[model samples]
Target: MTADRGVSTVVGYVLNLGIALLLVTGLLITTSGFVADQRHRAVEEGLGVVASHLAGDLATIDRLASTSDAEHVAVRADVPEQVAGRAYTIHVSPDGNTTKIQLVETRTGVTVTRSVHTSLTVSESTRGGGSLRFVYDDDGSIEVADD
Candidate 1:
């Protein structure tokens, strides 16, 4: 009887250990998922900032178009003053009909382009997580939908 009791005790302990391990594993997985989500959010926010800057520049180009007579206008935006540790390039091409703005992130391999008469398109490819492409249409609004 004592031996049976001892065996049962051991079995109980083993079962408890297994339960603990399973809980730990679940917690680890949950934590990992949370961290990944945070990183993705950060990257997305960075992209948002880049998009905003390009949109503002585009708006400026539209305004300039109304007043300026230049048929082909090109502006090289100064690297954004904020978002240190990241590098970006803004290219603007103004033609007789429409203006094209391209924003490229040197570090992330993300390209966002917008045309005066069309929607904004963004494409990103990276190791942490590969490409994301979306379009934002013009309607006095910010729209981000999968493409």
Candidate 2:
């Protein structure tokens, strides 16, 4: 009876150990997936913030061109290279009266586009580095220039 009791005790402990490990593994897998999902969401959110910011800035520039007394308005653009740990490229689509700014992630295909209503159309690149410049002409036209 004593021998059987010891063997059953050992077996019970082994079973408990196996169950604990299995539970831990399952929990780790679930947590990992959630973390990954949150990371993607964070990246997209960052892109949205950048897009909104640039759109607002461009709108202000357009207004400055229309309202300012200066014949030619020149301003420097302060832009970041990476948003949320990812590098990106910008695509500007200018129509007769509207400017569409598209920020596309280099590695991922995540893209955010913003359309700004303006009297002038402008173009610029937001890739990586340098002191970017923009010039608004007397005729209320805007153009991106190398600074």
Candidate 3:
């Protein structure tokens, strides 16, 4: 009777330890996936805000170039060098009636596009993100380039 009593207690302890380890492993795996999803969401929102700001800046420069008598207009855009811990690219392209300002992150390939309403013609160009200069030339053309 005494031997049988000790056997059941030892078996119970071993079973409990195994169950606890399994539960902890499962929790770690699930939380890792959740963390990755949250990181991706943050990256998307950050890119979107940057794209919108650039588009607004482009529109402002266009208005000034079209209405003012300035021969060469260069407006410095205050933009971040990196988005979500990664460098990005800025692309300006014509999309039908509106011009599209698209930002693409370097490693992640996350892209966000914003449209600007401008009468002045925007040249299709791709430039690295960071300090930027929007130039309105004497010939009535607007271009974006690295500052």
Candidate 4:
């Protein structure tokens, strides 16, 4: 009966280990999804803020370019190079009479768009995120490009 008792103890130990392992695996899987979702939200919010700031900057440039007598107008915009550890691109596109600034995350494909309240027309362009230049082009349109 001693051998039987030993066999029962071993079986119980193995079963306990299996249950603990399963519980840990389950917890990891659940938390991993939550983390990913949180990360995506962060990226989206970050991009939105960036887009708004860029739009505001574009508007400011438009006003300055319209009022000033300077032949060449260039404004430097200081923006982050990366959002949530991901690189992104900035796109300036004209939608009919309205101008839109779109920011797109390279890896995750997250995108945010904001309208620029500018009197001057905006030329369509795409540039990587970083310090950008808003130039009053000779063609009488605002352009966003790499610095």
| lDDT by residue (tens digit), candidate 3, 12-59 | 999999999999999999999998788678888998998888888898
Against the true structure, what is each candidate's TM-score? 0.45, 0.74, 0.85, 0.93
Alpha-carbon deviation at 146 in model 4, angstroms: 1.2
Candidates 3 and 4 compared by lDDT, better number: 4
Better of 1 and 3 by lDDT: 3
Candidate 4: stretches off by over 4 Å:
none
Task: Provide the lDDT at 77 for model 4.
Answer: 89
The best-first sequence of candidates by lDDT reads 4, 3, 2, 1
TM-score: which candidate is best? Answer: 4
Error of 3 at 43 (Å): 0.8
Rank candidates by TM-score, best first. Answer: 4, 3, 2, 1
Please tell me which model should have the higher lDDT, number 1 or number 2: 2
The residue pairs found clashing in candidate 1 are: none
lDDT over C-alpha atoms for residue 76 of model 4: 88
Local distance difference test, per candidate?
0.50, 0.76, 0.87, 0.88
Report the number of clashing residue pairs per model.
0, 0, 0, 0
| lDDT of candidate 1 over 52-121, digit per residue (tens) | 6555654554454445655533333333433334455555454445556565556546566665643322
- Candidate 1's C-alpha runs over 4 A off are 58-96, 100-113, 116-147
